[model samples]
Target: MTFHVELDEPRCVASGQCAVVAPDVFDQRDDDGVAVILDESPADDLLDDVREAVAICPAAALRLVEG
Candidate 1:
């Protein structure tokens, strides 16, 4: 299965919690401090952290797309 993640800018608050949980899969733009999905399909072991990031998103901007 392939997993995907995305951040809707209007809902994003630039908390950077996703990066804290899974740096390899998430990053923030230096110019605007916006969340970016670096890698949607991270390793299975990192799935937990990705899910945690989704759960912890303050603005509820994070979304998961399953394939």
Candidate 2:
């Protein structure tokens, strides 16, 4: 199964937790530190880290959809 990452930019709080947990899949904007999706469809090996990022997001801005 492949997972797609969705980020609600309006809901982001710029906490930078997502980047800390999943650098390969998530990053922060240089100007505002908003969460940015580096990889919309991450590889299976990075799923665990992505899951952690979604769970740890304080603003609940990150979502994972299986397709």
Candidate 3:
């Protein structure tokens, strides 16, 4: 299984929740502070943190599509 992680930059509030929850998968851009996808398809072990990041995103800017 693979997960597709996407970030809606316009909706991001730069809260950095995703980064905190899953640093290996999510990060903030140096200039805008918007959330960026470091790893679109992370390993299974990181799935939990990725899901938590998606859930805890304050602006609902993060999404997870599993396939």
Give the winner by TM-score: 2
TM-scores of the models, in the given order?
0.85, 0.96, 0.93
Worst 10 residues of 1 by lDDT: 39-48
Residue-wise lDDT of candidate 2 within 1-67, one digit each (tens)?
7999999999999999999999999999999999999999999999999999999999999999977
Compare the candidates by lDDT and give the number of the best one.
Answer: 2
lDDT of 1 by residue, 37-67 (tens): 8886777777788889999999999987767
Model 1, runs deviating above 4 Å: none
Instruction: Kindly report which residue pairs in candidate 3 clash with one another.
Output: none
> What's the best-to-worst order under lDDT?
2, 3, 1
Residue-by-residue lDDT tens digits, candidate 3, 1-67: 7888888889999999999999999989889888889999899899999999999999999999998
> Number of clashes in model 3?
0
Candidate 2, TM-score vs. the true structure? Answer: 0.96
Give the distance in Å from residue 11's predicted Cα in candidate 3 to where it truly belongs.
0.6
- What TM-score, to 2 decimals, does candidate 3 have? 0.93
lDDT of 3 at 57: 94
